[model samples]
Target: MPILKDFRYHAPVGVDEALALLHKSKKPLLLGGGTFVLNTLKKTAAYPTDVIGLRKIASLHGIRDAAKEVTIGSMTTLAEVASSPVVGEHFASLAGAAACVATTPLRHMATIGGNVASRFFWVDLPSVLMALGAKVAWAGDKAKKTLSVEDFLSLTGPEARGIVTEVLLPKSGLTGVYFRHTQTMEVDLPLVAMAFAARRQAGGVKDVRCIVNTTLSRPVRLTGVASYFETKKVTEWKADEAADVLRRDLEQGKLDDYRLHCLCADLESLIDKFKKA
Candidate 1:
């Protein structure tokens, strides 16, 4: 571990108080569960003069299940997410993704907000969130707004001057499945991943969303692969044909053969799941 430089840390009890502190502090960094920021602070020279910790904020910590969607507070930890029966019942892909993060203790310390806000391309949540068609409720200097996970990730430095308040997951009667691959143990950083989701329509499935996290850049949506699966019945889906289209979908991604092989194998497993479903 690198040496963590000296910095003044403030714990605010509410979002408004935290935002006020943010407005006044120069080069301030917001701390969520501290799994990412604390690690980052040890290595980065662009240190914050003030570290505003959001842990004390009560409003930022619960899972609310509504009739239309599930609202997860930004400060909700991965362990909380993984254990929430509502999350597991409604958003199985996200629940599975959360459960697969780091280890038990680390999961307890890592917030969903930190996971999404870090935008560390290689991390696990973004692709699964995108596959689930999730959105973030953001509070910023200018105004409050809701943006899709894809749009939220696309924001640049200046444009990202805000905090994510909540992650909104709509209930769409969709079945979601996630598959992750790592070079070594299951706890290792994933080399690649795939998130598959779709709604069962009459005689077939529709709204197919196939997402691949390359762990290189932004996660790619496998539109070609999704299109191929969209029109076909679950029984008609074949692994070899799906693999061929997946290769075309990933033509520009320039992934190494190993990553591609893992993804193909996962795709075959996904097809098997569909058949079983």
Candidate 2:
């Protein structure tokens, strides 16, 4: 049985209060939906002295749709993101990733903010968010920063620690699609995944973004694959040809044969979907 050690728990109703509590504690852990943090606490040997619960903060809740963009609060759960009409309409890939996270009860308790902040490479949303060109609105003791999701994901060590206040996704009119391959249907966690987004022009596409989550490293941008597909008419896309480009894009990556095969299969599916679109 896992045992939680004695710790101070602080539920702050405001961001300012939460920050104060965070900076004051000797070892502080931020609690969002409590899906990740609570579970980590049960097994972590390096226990935090204080757990700052952000659930009560009024500012960190809800999904808001505006003329220019959609804002999802940090505390918003995966279940909420998956079910949101605005998210479903504007960012289908994000909604799909959220829906694919875990079992029903886990989705209800796991948050988008926690998922992103956890920085676990196997987690579903980051690659999709990267493909959608989302920005993370973050607050820390030093500054309030809004970083591109790609930039945020590249942060390492202490640079990654902060309060993710919200995710800002612009209404770019880009269609996004996500494909994740799990080791088994029983496990919702992704073993490898791909997120593709592009703006469909009259006969071609523009601003194409292809991001792949190897679950072995940071989500890799398939630049060659994106470049190959860019400005080409949908009719010109050949799955086999695109697979060759994908192979070149991942040549530098240390992927095993099975995962590589899976990515190639995903590429074919993506091309076929777009061709039929």
Candidate 3:
């Protein structure tokens, strides 16, 4: 069995206390449910000297719905988000993505904050949140701030170190779909994942956003393909044309041909469903 290296554990009850602990520690790592951090420390040689648990912070534990937006606390578990009626009704794709993460047990333990903060490419939430145009609110010793999900995903090192407080989803009722291609149905990391959102205007797609995450390091928005789709009539859109646009934008040779083909086919199917709706 893998063992976690020696570390001092601190549980802070408030955001200010947590931030103070984080700033004072020599090598502090934030803990939210401890699914990702604990597992990594168990299996990997790298470890932090201090582990600061955020579970004691009461503010980071609930979902709040506003007139124009919905805010989900970072410490809220994947299971909570998956089963939330508000989330399901407003952002079905995000709910679906949350439900599909790992298994029942892991979902119960994996917090949304930990999942987003880790920024693991294989994870499902990041891509769907990005497609939905969500914003992330974070706090640190310096100050609290917010960033677009796209911008948050692109950050690295110190820029991404703050305590993720909540994820804000816009109330705009856009249709979205989340697709994950795994080798088996029995809970495994996806070979390719895609999340797409589009608004229909005058029977044509408008405000389109498509995010793709493969075996690569991070998910990226396929702006070129989204642009192409925006120009075509929803009813007139063809699968082959969509595939060709994705193929060109993705630079065909970088990914395994078969996997890319499957992704393209799935994306076409997703678009077809949107067209029919």
Off by over 4 Å in 3: none
- CA lDDT for candidate 3: 0.86
* TM-score, every prediction: 0.97, 0.97, 0.94
lDDT of 1 by residue, 113-194 (tens): 9999999988999999899999999887878899999999998866787788999999997899999988898457888999
lDDT of each: 0.91, 0.90, 0.86
Give me candidate 1's TM-score against the actual structure: 0.97
**Clash numbers, per candidate:** 0, 0, 0
Residue 260 of model 2 has an lDDT of: 87
Candidate 3 lDDT at 50 equals 88
The RMSD of every model to the true structure, in order and in angstroms, is 1.2, 1.1, 1.6
Residue 146 lDDT, candidate 2, scale 0-100 = 96
lDDT of 2 at 273: 88
Residue 118 local lDDT, model 2: 88
Candidate 2 on 190-240: residue-level lDDT in tens? 999999999998878889999999998889999999988885788998888
- In the range 1-277, model 3's lDDT, one tens digit per residue, is 7665689999989988888888888888899988878767877655788889999899999899999999999999999999999999999999999998888999999999988888877777888898998999988456788988768878777766679999999988788889888868875877788899988788787889998878576887787789988998877787888888888878843878767887788778886797677
Q: What's the best-to-worst order under TM-score? A: 2, 1, 3
Name the 10 consecutive residues with the lowest summed lDDT in model 3: 38-47
Off by over 4 Å in 2: none
